[model samples]
Target chain A: MRPAAPMSIKPQADAVQLVLAALIAFALALPFATLKPNRIVPGQPLFLLDGPPFWARALVILALIALATVTWLGCRPSLRIVVTATALMAVILALGSTAGHLPPSNAYARLSPAAGFWLLTGALGLGIADGFARLKPSPLAGLMAVLAAVLILAGLFSSGWLSGISILREYQGRSDVFWREAVQHVWLAIGSLAAAIIIGIPFGLLCHRRPRLKAVALNGLNIVQTIPSIALFGILIGPMAWIGSHVPGASALGIAGIGAAPAFVALLLYSLLPMVANTLSGLAAVPRDLIEAARGMGMTDRQRLWKVEVPLALPVLLAAVRIVLVQNIGLATVAALIGGGGFGVFVFQGLGQNAADLILLGALPTVGLAFVAAVIMDALIAWSAPRKGRGSIA
Target chain B: MTFASRAIPRLIGLCLLLGLFLQPQLFEPVFRPLANTSAPSIYAQAELWSLALSHVVLALGATLGALILAVSAAVVVTRSWGASFLPLSRSIANIGQTFPPVAVLALAVPALGFGDRPTFVALLIYGLLPIFETTLTGLTTLPAPVMEAARGSGMTEWQCLRTVELPLALPLIVAGFRLSLVIGLSTAAIGSTVAARTLGEVIIAGLQSNNLAFIVQGGLAVAGLAVLAHDALTALEIWARRRTRLAV
Candidate 1:
């Protein structure tokens, strides 16, 4: 053995590690809270050092150290994921406990986490998920990790571990109203989607049959989509109010200028473009050979449409449903401006009150709803895909 | 026949642009029936042209920002070294879409302290996903043979991307840009709520006072912009496709 062949090692730097390091550095340096006496009052800067207990602080430091160590060692992918996940959990617990323990200096005084805290938490959470994703390409794993974290967080919240947080206080005060608004929000979204499908599918089929109609219908819906949510809401009010007052039975059935009526109509109109366009596209995508074969088998136009076209089109159509549902859930937040009760009520109230926590209280749930809708729709599309097309469709 | 086919959409687009400028005079007669009602006439209150110009500017700015960010992101993810970042980039784009623009405004206001900044942020976020996704689709779905041929000719990665791939993908990318621009136009209207100068101010005021004319003015201006922009972009896409076909 001639003096052991010289070994050459190439130093490698992971971009992910570099990003995590920068994020940790930023979190350490920035002020974690803008301390305030109450929701309405302006907050003064409160650094991390001025807040969180020593152990909580230590946990944050430890997490950051662990992340750095993993980066330095260039650990195995699985080990990196586990370390990142643990660090994330530690950061979450530390932040939560810190927020929960912020002493209520007075009955009115409230301590709220500021921009830095939000940025740090979001970065840590995202980093951990990205790490998990790097370990395995599946989105489901990252999603499961997120679900686990959320469950743990929720458990903490419910068990009174996080009761002292300002946002929780906001929730505690309006828990009933929050639930009511959430229900109302979901109801409005579902109602508009149902209405859109009922009206849109027939219109789409009509457009599909008549090439001339397709252009006009599509252009009209596109124009409708171009109208801003607020403008659409505003436009609906005059006509709706006029109809409500002049039409005898309209008011009795809740068709008013304001409240849910205009909101529902606007949302329905918004949903139409996606529903109709998708229907048209999905139908168009059905293979010409398949349709011809169906016809050759003595299938009538109706049978071909029902049995062949729709079955083939189901995936795309379901995709459209997902898009419309998610879009409506988001758009419905603006409905609150017109007395259409929903999460927007909390949003506007928060805006008016100058309370960031209240806004988060409202906004987070809306995001949650949209996420749920997306996931469900994705699952539905996956389930509905033809067995032969599963590999191709995704 | 080709000229005629192309001319029709151009004509429609030009007509819409002309109509947008002439809306006050043209719509005055049409809105006369409502003038007698409690709501004020649309042209009576403010300069529709200025509001329309502001709306266009906001949308254009947001679209430019979104296009730059999205195209760069798309390009990065398609590269060999950055390929692993694709899912991450996609999720980031999805998150941008997942948060409502209104919520973005609310959250941004706290950090940026309300005005055009938050509005810009919201519009940029809202517009990003469409362009990014479409660009990705355009880049990723290039004909394998064409790509192989380009590489077979000893073209550098950047050169291939710049000369062949980009040209091929231009139409679809432009389509995505058009979608983002239209969305930005619509969404920028909500910027009014955050103290951003937009046509939405007209609409919001209308909502507050129950003024149909104001709503019509704002809505018409925004919608007209959208339709005209859409037509122009569609024409561009068609032209790009034709050019690519001719090149091939």
Candidate 2:
């Protein structure tokens, strides 16, 4: 048999390249719908090659070809490919804007980008990110790219290029109510998180001190966690309603069954498992030697806990807080179902009216809030952790 | 560790399961007092067992789909050539979890035209990240020495992976499955909003009609399912851990 040619250690197309190529191919082959006249109506769709002005279509084709070339040629020009991908994404966004301007003024037609438009935009964004990742760009560089893209999109939005979009129109019609509901959503999430920390920490501490109670307490909490959020809300209503009616001045405090009271209570209960479980684990994790040293130094129980244990446990506790905060932000959306005024009001209303734009209006902000909460909590945990290590040395 | 002691937990679990299924018959007296004066009885409208079964089926379908996708992706990424795609996979999974299921349902309804398909899509997406992360963790953290020994034993790469790595990673992979299953159970209730047959329909009807009995029944059924599933999985995890300990 002829000896096989010595294996040339050539790098094949990596996952990112293959994925980007597939995405671009899918975008090219799919039909891009230019507009939908209303929220419920279906729109006319045409192939990307068939739609848009000649120059715009040419630019898109060129960008796709460049991406394909990079996929085949391998990693040598990844950075340039990323820049091209980012430009392509921006162009797609602009194209979305320009498409909105296609229908006549005073037509009351709502412009909606079709599946292909969304797919192409998403693919381009992912491709850009993948390219940047391959190049090992700084975090700040990624942030700057995102900010620049946002600014360009904002400019387009301000110039009314996307005026015909239904979601934006939904926002414009209910700006006041939107702001009110957003504020309420924040307030509900924050209130429950604060309550959970206050109650859960002490509860956790008690469980930690009494090993016998730990299993029962944790098991109870586990069961609580498993109860669906809606179920918890449902279970709370009767008790809340009874309290509002029977207790003197409770109604004045807004403790009704079908409103914020039940929502708040359910949210607090949901937050407790994470808060308490984390606190218990954090306390348990405090090194035995450190506590013994504190005791040998003649520190009292309260002093030892406050000065040493709390500080040592702070990182884990912060992690719990992070979990609770992010979870509560998501859970509070269900409060709207119970007449607790929040962004969920828009969600339910949209569902009731069969209006997808209104649903997007509510859902996007809720997701954004949850994302922001997660990021902030993560940052806090990272910041607090290193400081504790440094403080122990000092 | 004895049979009787182990049997105790199982017995209790069985009792809980029986009680949950028989809730309408068993709890009728309790619910009768709480029933709204104007509305029809909760159990009269729908069969609780059927709803519970359908809920499980939906969750199972989603969890199974998520498991296959996540495991495939995790396995591929753990391979040397696919390692660079780890961050990309992670971010994609993260986005799946970040988008609320309600929003998913809303957007999907337009394309999928409502019912089980949209709900399935939502659950599939929602369930992907946890399993994916766990599988990634399980595969990457396999004992390096064990893997090396397998390679040294004249095993091919695929055989080493199949025989050495996956067996060791089974417990963690099971943990991931458990988590995704529990999450799927809770999230599947929202499927009713999209006209999918789920326990959420009973709860929604309860809310709309202001019937406390209906709400209680639905809520109790869902809570029971979650608790039972959780306990069963916890048992499985413990068993897997023990088996692995013996094997090692």
Q: How many residue pairs clash in each candidate at the backbone level? A: 1, 0
Per-candidate Cα RMSD to the true structure, in Å, reads 3.6, 3.8
Instruction: Give the per-residue lDDT digits (tens) of candidate 2, residues A1-394.
Output: 9977856644457767677668767876777654666667666665667666676677777766665655655646455556565557545554555464556764556655567777877777676656655665443454455556557656766777556566777887898999999999999999999999999999999999998898888878888998888788887888999999999999999999899999999989989999999998889888898899999999999999999888888989999998788778877878887788788888778877877778778887887677656656655676677454486633
Q: What local lDDT score does residue B182 receive in model 2, on the 0 to 100 scale?
A: 81
TM per prediction: 0.89, 0.89
Model 1: per-residue Cα lDDT at residue A110? 65
The whole-model lDDT of each prediction reads 0.79, 0.77
Interface RMSD of 2: 2.0
Q: What is the lDDT of residue B14 in candidate 2?
A: 69
Error of 2 at B227 (Å): 0.9
Model 1 chain A: lowest-lDDT 10 consecutive positions: A4-13
